[model samples]
Target: MLVSLIFKRTYRPNVNTIQWNKTIQNHQSNGNYQQALKLFQLGIEKNTFQPNSVTYLTILDICKELKSLPTVRKIHHLIDESKNLNNDDIQNNPRIRSLLMDVYIKCQDIDSAYKIFQSMNERNLIDYCAIMTGFNHQKQYEKTFELSKQIPASIKYSSPVLCTLILQACIELNKYDDGYKIHQYGKKFLPNNKIFMNELLNFYLKFHQEKQALDIFDKYQNQQTIIDYSLLMKYYNRQYQPDKTIELCYRLKNHSHIQIDHIIYVLVLQAIANGCCLHTSEQIYNQIKKSQTHMDINNALINMYGKLGNLDQAEKIFNSMSKHNIVSYNILLNLYGLYYQSDKALKTYHQMCQHGHQPDDKTYVLLLHTLSQTPNKINDVKRIFSTIEEHKRGPMVTAAMIAALIRAQLFDEVNDLLKKLPKENILFYAMKANSNETNEKFHYPISITNEQLALYDLLMSNIYTYAGLHDRLTNVDEILYENKILKDRLSYSWFERSNGKIEYFKSEQLQLKTCEHTEKLALINALDEQKNSSSPILIGKNHRTCTECHDYFKKVSLSSSQKKVYLRDSTRFHIFSNGTCSCEISS
Candidate 1:
């Protein structure tokens, strides 16, 4: 009798909604969000007879999945029209409010989400917790605290969602004191919500507050699902606590709901790779294949072999993939480039493009970087640059190309490259975030000269040294410390180098000032004069080369600034001030 009823929950009497739900689930699982959304709407319109919050939440789920604000508002209105929200079974509609709030949060419509929270005047702690979770989702930590104040004291603070929000926000902002206070508050409501307890443990472990983190882990770690264990183990691997990571995985093996995922398996493999235990990672990967889950663990294998510098094994594993993804190509391209195998890198690029996979920004950046390593390969950089377009460029690519141009001392070309960019400088952008600096854009082409091509190689070497790219930094540093002239040229263009070294140009000489008799008269018609005096910054196509005067500016610049200041040869005017710069390059 129980078995019959257990099966009945999934049996939809309305055959249309059932079929649509299956399609919706399939589309969602594949991350084809738009298809999922349309199918949900069709189901709702065609079968309003089976309307419930589950049906509405299905619509909301599609909104969250698609991240479509306009559709989400329309779905909310549909729910209002259905008035199933007025049903006595509000208790069964566990996720309707939460999912709606989630959609609003994803849309960044925080005000709309808050308004919904305001209308829920019955003020169940779950509702309060959901609102706090919504605020946290929006990364509005201050708002999370502000709303927490409104909850009545009769309601407990350790509501599953509130504790989780506080834990997440504290870590995000690095506010240890606030984390501690909420953590202390959390133990009271710990009897229910095992998920919250695991979250707290994860936060503690994140801060390396291990004593408390593990103690909590020991008390309720068994209560967690596979996700918590995998997360805990991943954190442990990061913290170099391999023993604990293994222990958690072992404990998780018994939980019926927990099973191996590619990510967790990858984490364990990483620990093996780090400890020089390639055999162990391989053993784990082999075991993972037997779990009845379809996952390509080839990337993990490649990464392991990569660490050992065993290109043969890495390549063997890469070739074994039935269908290669962008990540697989990127990893191999990087390895070949790392060895300065320029011919190999170019060939790989051809293979990738031939396979109908357009190379992302990193692919182009990697090629340019390898080209920067050798003078012979300089043409490759020029060819690649000419293939790019401004709109497709990103900060990392722009910065890399800018440094490359500067290294070639194509002083006049910097303006063209920069005008294509959105920022005043790439350094300012890198400061705001890590590797959000995507160079995946494959557009933004530019023409490059032989001199500019040579410069790309030199600048990339400097960048590699600074980033400590290889097994040793000296491969780059030796080149840097040796090239004092290059260093000086770079410095004059910017501020003082970090090393605070200065060197005067060898060709430094004074020049005789020649004044045109009509110079003052020209200024009287200054706007007209300005048209003729537009800087050398124009693209080469716009102006013919003035070969006779090319060498004359250095002398003029030296005499004008009492040094080799930018005004003489520089394109953009730099008005130098006390010991610093304003648009500090050159005029």
Candidate 2:
């Protein structure tokens, strides 16, 4: 009857008439925030302002909805105008006090919540619980713990709620011991309470207390949630203990029905991807498609396809999506770029943008590396409003840009980029710090520190021994090695880790090597002349020359024979004849 009175579209003089408040409370308790707000507003429009009571709270309800400070303050104005809000009422009434705190919290008015918390004349466990929850939400971690401590031992705190807070704080502080104790309290509610038990198990798992977590799981074996199965897998995955994680997944399924969520599948896929067996992961993708309950499965499919290098299948899956989200598009774009399908990569990028996904740094870097290779797009940096150096901030991306700059022969620009980097930014420097003490000579060869000599020596040696000068190569390494001036160089004991040969650096090769200095110089001259020529090229093995020979093949793009040419020798082949060959944009 009271609820009907509070709920019905009628007015009651005594606003405290439990009926009046009950109607509004019922809707709110059921999670109908919008309906509750409207009902509360309707009450305000109908009822004359009541002093110190439920009416102010109903107004607070609407304020909580808007979650805006200005509106909440206006409500506070109405709260103040009411003759009802007195020191006496706030002191005596628990409901009114709780409502005030909640409203301030919803408004994000922390100061007001604290102010009201201070004024509460009577406080109970529930009141304390409310404020503590409020503090946790506001991210006042220290205060949340401080208040938690103040709750008397006699009053049992909600184990689940307090556990959640302690779990978060412990994770942040890396204080797993205190976090362990909090897990003990969780079992108090675990016997008949499966929900609490699951949460407790999850807490243990999260804090690296896997033993306790597994114990909880085993204890509740008859009644395991999907979470138990998923977490067991994830826990092992995090520890990098893949075998055990996979073992747990199989164990749970053998005993009971384990429904795998998308997240768990993703973790499993990741676990498999990092390991050597891409083929095994392909099986999982097939299984997911065969499942009848697979409501949403595209994320896993894309990952599986990308890792397996099945571009055709991956693209089909991607293009067929009702909505190709950023993650999907990025994967497709990057996959195409990696496989050297530059045209398809640009198409995917355009498709992604048309779908409203703007390319981020990674996307631009992938395309830029490809674009940097061509004369048609030599000015990729200026086109993108970002410099190669600035965009190459990440080591991997910077590596691609480094290769591009070397290929373009932009030495000064390359040097400036290197100059901007700190000593640690250089890769070998980091390795050197952790290396054993050694004579610097083993690292650079010359005591005075010549970049060109050190690099040239390294490149020439590498080509001679391993990749070979004729290995359809780019001279980025050779050029870097040849730079004579270096600002900071490290003494790496591991420089000898690369067992390149001495034949290239051996002055004796000047005579017997496949191509002489004059041959290279002639090619360079030809290349120089053609650099200014807007000519097409077609060259082949017949017309191909050594790096020394092709130095003049700049118009070799205009090589009339085969579309491209490589200068071959006893080792490997250099890919250009007259500075013009097929593999130009980026290696």
* Tens digits of per-residue lDDT for model 1, 438-462: 5332221222222222233334444
Model 2: weakest 10-residue lDDT segment is 490-499
lDDT for each of the candidates? 0.53, 0.50
TM-score of each: 0.54, 0.59
Task: Kindly report which residue stretches of model 1 are placed more than 4 angstroms away from their true locations once superposed.
Answer: 1-110, 119-122, 138-142, 156-158, 189-192, 219-221, 236-259, 274-296, 356-361, 385-392, 402-587
Residue-level lDDT of model 2, residues 466-510, one tens digit each, is 334452322322222343222111110000001111001111221
All predictions: root-mean-square deviation over Cα? 19.7, 14.9
Clashing residue pairs in all predictions, respectively, total 13, 37
Error of 2 at 402 (Å): 7.2
- Count of clashing pairs, candidate 2: 37
